[model samples]
Target: MNDTPGWASPGSAPSDGQDATVPRPSEPADSGGASSKWSAAQPPAGQWSPPSGPDGTPAPAPGPAAGWGGPSHTGGPGHNGPHHGWGAPPAAKPGVIPLRPLGIGEILDGAVSTLRAHWRAVLSVTLVVAVVSQIGDILVQRYLLPAPVEVDPNASPSEALDQAADSAKASLVALAPSLAITLIGTLFTTAILTVVISRSVLGRPVTLSDAWREARPRLPQLLGLTLLLPLISVAITMVGIGPGLLIGSAGGVALTFLGGTAAVVVAIWLMIRFSLASPALMLERQGVIASMRRSAKLVHNAWWRVFGVQAITLLLTFLVSLVIGIPFGIIAMAVDGDGLGGLLSGSSPEFGWPYLIISGIGAVIASAITYPISAGVTALLYVDQRIRREALDLELARAAGVPGYGSDRPGHGPTGG
Candidate 1:
């Protein structure tokens, strides 16, 4: 008994004693924890009861709260998720052409798409412009030109020259007011149409009256911008050309050539830069000076792009006009036999109602197709600028009711897919 370990005794349990040798019910087994024991005692995974709360009611499984994801998170088809970059189009592929450095083809494609989408608006605006242009053309053709004076065949050469010069001066003076009116009307109309087309392309609401209202305020600025070219021409002519011609007549050919070339270059540059001024003036609601400035800014980095697009548009328009005009011209020539001479001779070409009607119809059709193209291009130019400056593509998509990316719904794709 004495040889036994001091920590053990006869009356006490062995070193591995569990409260006098019997395991205590309250103590957990070393090999089996409570959770493990419970799990083992419970049914297998398939046969187990659904998870329950402490109160014994089943707990809800995790899922999207509504048809889409939870309100806090974007989680649906077409919903650009949290990871999307700001001002970036979700649908836009990476490494494609950047929007900032837009190419001529992109601009033209945008313009064409706009026209295709909003043909009605484009047609309506074009019709109005065409009607006004045609009426103005007719007035100028019929009423602005002076009647040729009846000159005696026996009149002296000097007298004939004097009479012709005087007649020419008088005709120009008489046509001035009509010309001014026509220019003003055309500029105002074009400005309004440009605004309408721009708004339409942007998916903004616009009515004819609204377009007119929007354009009215900018008319003064537009008129100022429009007058700039003629004013500059007049100034250069008065100060440079007039003086140059006078001096050149006295043996200063260098001055004349230099002055003329400078004037031509300046005029061309100004015209090219301001070609998009009407659209800027309309869409931006800018003052004439400001609109001009804005146009200069927008065109600065992309002058060639603007120039190319405009040139292409002009060429296309010219080709279309030729296609239409050639047939009409041929018909007119056929009807007039030998053409202008025969028609003006005693043969007296009949101004038949049918001819007038056909010409009018042709004009309308041509206008319908071409007007939209021009308007749409201008609108697209405006859009391109906004896209460069303001990330307008995102705005446009939002306006088009595209989903996701901080829109009202969560978990929706950017394109509302």
Candidate 2:
């Protein structure tokens, strides 16, 4: 049996311990009608060797290639070469996923599986973060944020235009503090949940405190990465639209529209490219810049796959939020008394403490469920990419103490630290 690290073929479906019979190559069979019997021809040794290492050293060939070309095809009980009719071992499943290149379904399932396995720790982190965020948002909306601007239907066109501008400005102002709160909350939850997910990958149970302890030192770097990415996107957008705004003519309107669309496209591309940086940063202990570079490297040929996973996850979370929030919203409006009337009359709803508290509970519940899934997917995607490109499954197998992959020897485990 070839037990070397990289011997397994990429994208091999995990087997179920049954002997998988491989068809013989197009060689003539004996009169007995058995395809297992091989011809007596032999091939040169170096012709079918594994690729050379970076240092120009040849990787060790995995024994005699019996079923293919290099001799040893006696088909006896003692034959130990790469023969047909023997089932390849399944990929090691020491944790939430098999230690192999993951498909989209596996990745999604792995994330949900982590949440299911470590619900206490994962939910604790997300719940606290969500509650704090919602509280801050509620307070900011109630006290600091200006009321929604009401547009008068009886007003002139200029007045309506002015009202629309004011409404936009007010909306921005109202959203700023909420966004800030959410960002900070997301930062903390990402750091802690990342630690939990990393441990979960190794099939290790983790406590909330243990995860927090491991993740605390990386918080500042994580914050930097989180803030830096948005800043970069904003800078790109400003640059794209700045020229048109400076010109400020009728043609500039068209230019601004085009430039803004282009900028948004670029921003989305860059964001998807850097999406894996958080898990890279948290798991690899990389700097913000180094993590971004690592993410770019990992995502180079997999942009659309990564983007598709992220988009699907985003849609799922959105749906979850909508499903959970609608009931709470209606209840809040009913309880608050004024919000229902405002909704019926097609105006901005005035939210009081009763409405805010009820709605905040729904937001908390939605966030608690969604946060872990999002973070888990990102972390698992990082693991999946590394396994595909770098044979990280071998290392993971060893770390997870799978029997055949040299688990008895001392080695570095996959860890967030």
Best by lDDT: 2
TM-score of each: 0.59, 0.77
Model 2, runs deviating above 4 Å: 1-86, 150-166, 407-417
RMSD of each: 24.5, 12.5
Per-residue lDDT tens digits for candidate 1, residues 1-417, read 111001011122111122242112245565554445444566556776668988988988765434343112111112222323343333431111222325567556665655665556556666776676655655554555565555566767656655654675677676676667556655755776676555554355556666676667777777887888567665764565455556534344457667778877676677667776777666555667766766776566567767777888888877887788678766655554444455668653544444444455566567656666665676566556545433434434443443442352332222232
Q: Which regions of candidate 1 fall more than 4 Å away from where they truly are?
A: 1-101, 146-185, 204-207, 233-240, 248-258, 337-339, 342-365, 398-401, 405-417
Which tens-of-lDDT digit does each residue in 41-114 have in candidate 2? 87866677668978999977666353333211212122212232344445678889887677788888998999
**TM-score of structure candidate 1:** 0.59
> What lDDT is reached at residue 130 by model 2?
94
Q: Candidate 1 local accuracy as lDDT? A: 0.54
Ten-residue segment with the worst summed lDDT in candidate 2? 71-80
